[model samples]
Target: MSQLYVAVLAIIVAVLLAVALYRATRVKTKADYLVAGRSLPAAVLVLTLLTSWIGAGSLFAGAENAYKNGFAALWQPAGGWLGLLLIYFIAPRARKFAQFTLPDLLEARYNQTARVLGTLAILFAYVGITSYQFKGGGDVLHLIFPDTVSSQLGTYIIALFVIVTTALAGMSSVAYMDVAIGSLVTCICIISAPSLLHQAGGWSALHSSLPPQYFEIFGNYRLSPHGVLQSPAMGLVRALEFLVPTMLLMLGNQVMYQKFFSAKSERDARNSVIGWIIGTVVLETLIVAIAVFGRALYPTGEVAQHPREIIPYTARHGLPAILGAVLLGAVFAKVISTASNYLFSPATNLVNDVFVRYLAPNASNKRVLIVSRLAVVLLGCWALYQAIYAESILQKMLWAYTIYSAALTPVVLAAFYSKRVTAWGAVAAIASGTVVTLAWDLPGVKSLFPHIISDRDAIFPALFVAIAALIIVSLFTPAPSEAQLAQVAE
Candidate 1:
């Protein structure tokens, strides 16, 4: 029942998973391997979306907010469900468009300039997000081990595991692995949630033992009127930060779009979004509970302790040894599967959309696949290094969402809804959004612009400016020729 033994059990599960995925997937056809042959059934697609979306970010970040804010923290996840709602309406259209990545769709909708710019935007966003997951996995591994294993070494191992698996079969491998991990994780969460509550002495016990503010929605003024700016707490702003990125997620981005591509049909893709939304509502609530309980159980002042460790710490003490061990493995499964799936998407996009299409349009699919595998290694290394140097788990998740949303969301949305969007518009939107967001931490910048103004205005302003420029320019300029217009309609 030692934590060390529990940790060992988790590693064994991951190893077994790797071996099983390696044997099950024998990649040859690019379509079959990179995207599950573009024929994923509803069941597999649903579960994979569920697993891929809810990584350490949900478990750790959700837990952190729950720990810090109590029941009011539930609003954090409520925002994500809103995102899933948006996805349901948007996904089928994306799939019907039949593209490799979001940028692929934009290229068809607008022009090559749009495609190229969107691709660059996603690369920055995804790498930043994936890097955090890399860092989180490494941190978790180091915590699972001790003196015999250094944190840096542990990070490298987890990073390697992710990079190697992603390189194996692209989305094809990520999908099947997601199904298994998602199901296992679902069972673990169901088991762990109740036990965590029990350790807190049941719902009534948890309800009464805390500060009076624990149960309030605005416990810390997070949702207050002033929350948008000049507020003492991060409540409203945090919620906005969570909301805007998720809104973009529902609109653009390859991760969700790929799910749409892999769906058996339009119905399946739409249904999967609803299913994921439902699951997010339930699981996020459960994670929030675990985080609150964890807060009460393990306070500060340990040699090594942080909020992300809350789930593991509580499971080791609050649940029976065997059940705790199983849940622990599920935690790792959540982290690794997400890392594997996310890292693969951008790599594939880079090779197929940018490298093969622009660099050498006539390159065989086989060669493109090989290049994709290499991109996975190169990107994976970048993510792994950042993961080691990064702080706790939640920040990385935010980093990626912020960058991607600010850059790609506008351009992605423009593709589907705006007929006037042009290549120049796409380029301008990406450049403006990225510049504003990246300079967010600058000294004079914050004072001049401030997080309040800078945050809201950054992406949205860039998006609108891009749209206006595209419309004005396209009006004066000739529209797409009939042939290009045909491609756009398709």
Candidate 2:
């Protein structure tokens, strides 16, 4: 059975590599490498967007949340669903402002300082995200070949393959490969969810076997022995911690914006979001359901101990042979798809925002392409290093999400909607947000105000400081000039 799963995964990797190689041959210019020549249609855009957004974050971290918290886990993804509502209004405008990377938009609307600060924040957030995808892929590989492959070895294998594949054709390969992978994973999850429920003896069995709190919204606190139900405010705070970061990340996700830049037209970009919202809602709900069912089926043992592995463990032991193999393959491929998208985004930032913009404004297309590939290899190694030391998938996911949410989202949204936001204010927002988030959990800093910082998640403080800086500083300073405002004007 393990060998069958390995064979399916091996086949998927081969097909992905072949597609990547074919796409590599089509790369000719900087635009071709970074934005797929700005020619992707709505159909392709939808799948790529869906695949990029639903990653190890969904498969591992999200599954872990479901295993532990039940339906209340939906609060995390509910944030993304809400962000998608706002994105429907922003997508067409983003396409109209097409550029290579988010930093490009930042510089146009803010200043060079804001652009550089934004780039740094993106690197911190995105590299952390890519690292966990490596970790998740490694977990799946170890599961499939446990006798011979340790999780550490699996991490190295996944890192090497993802780096090489991402360096091959850039956005063209990533986007097209997603079309294949996203379809497989979406179909498999749709099938696996109902199948797993039936095998678990249906929803009636699930409710009876699991804690009754598992079925309630915000039931996360209710399961605790201390019974925090006495403090509903704390429950709301806990739920908001999950909700805000996911929503903010979606609103300002550079990966999503880059895909919009790749779209052939504004219509394509807007249309893609409609499909993306539907796919995301359906897929995320299924992921949580599958995880909850898997928990009920396997009440104890290894999976119960390491809840992050529930999805893959269910694939190996819970499902039938053929479906299990395919579902396992989908999990593996989705991780790679996400890692490539994230790894490629930061590389795009370094090459387009720093190297090409400042270091070699006159560099030839050939030279830029070479540097682009090199950046992917270097950043991928950085992500692999972080993966090596990472402890929990859900912890890493929230940390990365909060960094991007607090640091970049405020300034990015201001650029699109407010002419009163001056460049210095944007810089202040980015700097304060990044610093507070990174420092909020440190032992020394938490000790300074243990009551406020120790127990609370960083998103609340980080986002507050960021927004306050943006609004207060902008009000004190002169309004942005017409020139600055014009850059982002719709």
Candidate 3:
């Protein structure tokens, strides 16, 4: 029966790779490889964005949250929903200001220094993101073939697959394959949710099976690691801590903007947000419901230790063979899609923003494309190295989000909205936000500090320093000239 599951997964992957092989031929130029030659329609844009955003972070990390907290686990995605509302307004503008990468946007609006620093920040955060995707793909494989494939070996296999597929056709392969992967995952999850509910003895059983706290906004009690009762205000802060990272990630996600840049028109980019918002809410909600339903049936055992495995576990054990295979394959494909997107984004930053822009500005399209492929291989190796020492995907997701949100989001947003912001201000914001987040998380530095700051995650302190520096430094420094402002405005 498990062999049946593995066979179905192998078939789906083969079909996806074949499709990628076909798309690889269409990629001929730097723009073609990087942004699909800005040719994607709104429908393609919507699905790719959906697939990229909901990868392992939302599927596994978020499922783990729902497995523990039930409905209130929505705090993780509610942040993205908040971010999406703002994204609706920013989407068209991003498409209009079209560039290859986030660092391109930074350099246009700020300076070369901002571009270099922005690339550094993106590499740190995006590689961490890609690492977890490898971990997630490995987890799914291990669940299906627990005896045959160790999780570490599974990670290496997934990493190589993602790197090859991404390097084969770049965004062309990633975006189009996402169309199939996204639709399959969404349909399977929606269908499985009701079936799982029925098998678990329906909604009432799920409610009774879990703690009442699981139903609450922040859950019933917010206790410290020491088990002391925390104030409600502090609990809300903790919830915000979860919420803000998703919100910030969505707002500053280079992956989203790159997809937008790939759109055929600004209108296509703007319109896709509508579909993306709908898909995310429905699919993410179903993911939580699926995990919660799984918890009702498989409450104990390995799922407790590795809560992130709940979704795949439910698909294999709780669903019928065919439905289980479909669900598992969908989850696996999504992880691959997301890993490709994250893995590819920083490669673009290193190649387009750093290598070509600085090192070989006069390089031909052919040379640029070769460097891009090499960049993917090198970065993919780095991400896989991180996967070897993998921890909780949820912890890693927030850490990556904190770095991007605090360090880059403020400056990225200011570039479009404020002509008053100076290049030095952007530099200060980027540097301070990144340094604070990194320093706050360092073991030695954290050990030396007081609990109030060190005990907390990096989001608040990093954001505070970043935003403050942006405003204060901008006020004190010279504003950008008309030429500089117009670069972003147009």
Question: What lDDT score belongs to each candidate, Candidate 1 first?
Answer: 0.70, 0.94, 0.91
Candidate 1, residues 356-377, lDDT tens digits: the string is: 7779888776887788889999
Q: In angstroms, what RMSD does candidate 2 have relative to the true structure? A: 1.2
Which segments of candidate 3 are over 4 A away from where they belong?
A: 453-455
Point out where model 2 deviates above 4 Å: 222-230
**Colliding pairs, model 2:** none
For residue 413, model 3's alpha carbon misses the true position, in angstroms, by: 0.7
lDDT of 2 by residue, 1-490 (tens): 7678868988999999999999999999999999999999999999999999999999999999999889999999999999999999999989999999999999998889999999999999999999999999999999899889888899999999999999999999999999999999999999999999999998788889998878877767443345545366666778888999999999999999999999999999999999999999999999999999999999899888889999999999999999999999999999999999999999999999999999999999999999999999999999999999999999899999999999999999999998788888999999999999999878899778977775567898899999999999988988888987887777
> By summed lDDT, which 10 consecutive residues of candidate 1 come out lowest?
223-232
Worst 10 residues of 3 by lDDT: 220-229
Evaluated with lDDT, which candidate comes out highest? 2
Evaluate model 2: give its lDDT: 0.94
Per-residue accuracy of model 3 over 1-490 as CA lDDT, tens digit each = 8778878888888988997899888888999999999999999999999999999998899999888777778888999999999999999989998889988889888999999999999999999999999999999999988999988889989999999999998999999989999999999988999999999997688788888777777763365757676787877888888899889889999999999999999999999999999999999999988988888898999998999999999998999999998899999999999999999999999999888888999999899889999999999999999988978888888889999999999998898888899999999999999999989867788678867765478899899999999999999998888888888775
Clashing pairs in 3: none
TM-score of 3: 0.98
Over all chains combined, what TM-score does candidate 2 have?
0.98
